[model samples]
Target: MTRIFSALVIGLIFGAGIALSGMANPAKVLNFFDVAGSWDPSLAFVMGGALVVTAIGYTFVLKRKAPVFDRLFHLPTRRDIDRPLLAGSAVFGIGWGITGFCPGGAIPALGLGYSDAWVFVGSMVAGIALARLARHTMAARAAGKAV
Candidate 1:
């Protein structure tokens, strides 16, 4: 219950930050990507500020024995740069560049009632579903081969 409450509070804070920072605007995001044209550096500042805050927070938080909400930190252990990672990254970049909306931005942008945001979010869900299906299919094939 405590963990759930904490997560809810944290998520709300994050959403509020996104909304306040003007990151929910697709035009701002698109402008950031327009390097050859009028490239907006505002997103870079926001990202830098976020990175700095995260760095400072992580530095302090990691000094503790364990996370407040979890028994373990649950950090990712994989360090290898593999094909799926590369492919997924490329797809994500392409989608973001074209639509000016990543999943994080798009989800909040829906509050503004933009058609592009709606379409982006819908497509994002479909992509996630397809990825899950592909994973399941691959696992089944692997299991069959092992038998």
Candidate 2:
């Protein structure tokens, strides 16, 4: 189908971009995290480039009446910074500092057959599962008026 082919092409492009940008290298990410000795700031340039590209893409998407493939562009309406958001952000930052790999970069890093990448990805998935379980438990407790 057209959608499947389009998705594959998009994924390949994204993967190639990550590889080309040196983002798939754990050492580069680890270097960025290291502030004391031999710290590399090259990742900052990659982040800047990504930010610019994302901003432009978002602007273009907003200008369109509807997305090319989708019936409508679904954007998040929530603007409030709540407790869960703050806590999750803190956890993510700590994990990134400790593991040196975010989910996006982790996939390609895994493709390069790095053992650390597998460990990071496994831990990340476990964390996600644990978070979801906690959320469900909390929701159930709140429903019972137990808080």
Q: Write the per-residue lDDT of candidate 2 for residues 28-109, one digit (tens) a residue.
A: 8889988898799989999899899999989888999998888998999999999999999999888887777888888888
TM-score of each: 0.91, 0.92
lDDT tens readout by residue for model 1, 1-147:
998999889877887788788888888998999999989999999899999999999999999899987797988999999999999999999998888898878877888677899988888999999999888889989889541
Please, what is the whole-model Cα lDDT of each candidate in the order they appear? 0.88, 0.87
The stretch of ten residues in a row with the least summed lDDT in candidate 2 is: 138-147
Give me the candidate number with maximum lDDT: 1
Error of 2 at 135 (Å): 0.4
Candidate 2: clashing residue pairs, number? 0
